[model samples]
Target: MDIVVAITLFVLALLIGVEVIGKVPATLHTPLMSGANSIHGIVIVGVVIVAAHATSPLAWVFIFLAAVLGTMNVVGGYVVTDRMLEMFKSDKSKKGEGK
Candidate 1:
């Protein structure tokens, strides 16, 4: 059934996301975040699919939560990436001296 497939995919994605969060080292975290930002774009497709086909109040609630979570992933990922990149400004750049 469609519900079974959706649940399976969601669980698989959740497990893989947890594993990825656990294993990534601090030094690699920024690059990991950039990659994650790109992944959030994929979640857009899921949002659209859920929005178009949701048939019941419970389904609407689930879809709303999914949309909010997906949006947070996207916004948080970009914010983290931007913050990481901001930390890397060279001394010359700080002095407004970059070529």
Candidate 2:
């Protein structure tokens, strides 16, 4: 029952994430993604909880995967946001030249 509910909610979230909100403007997207990325950092707390409570081998494996995936989210999000910021910086330079 819990698994069914979780899967249902996951699918609903995935659909909304991919289809519903993807039409926003590019300028809006960077800030939205940066905010969402901050929320993704909460995965670290979840990973810690899972790690501390894990007992079975399968549980340990899942905990390890969570740790790795969470770390990737933290690092990848920063890289992407930094690149996005650079795009605006270059645009600023172009505008300055025209002034």
Best by lDDT: 2
Q: Provide the lowest-lDDT 10-residue window in model 2.
A: 19-28
The TM-score values for the models, in the order shown, are: 0.54, 0.61
lDDT of 2 by residue, 3-73 (tens): 99999999999887787665677776776678579567779888997788888999988988888899888
lDDT of 2: 0.81
Instruction: After superposing candidate 2 on the true structure, give the runs of residues whose Cα lies further than 4 Å from its correct spot.
Output: 1-26
- Could you tell me the TM-score of candidate 1? 0.54
Tens-digit per-residue lDDT, 9-99, candidate 1: 9999899888868766687677776867767666967897878988999999988888878878877777777666676555438778745
Candidate 2 residue pairs in backbone clash: none
Return the clash pairs for model 1, or none: none
Global lDDT scores for all candidate models? 0.77, 0.81
Model 1 lDDT vs. the true structure?
A: 0.77
Candidate 1 regions exceeding 4 Å error are 1-29, 90-99
Among the numbered candidates, top TM-score falls to 2
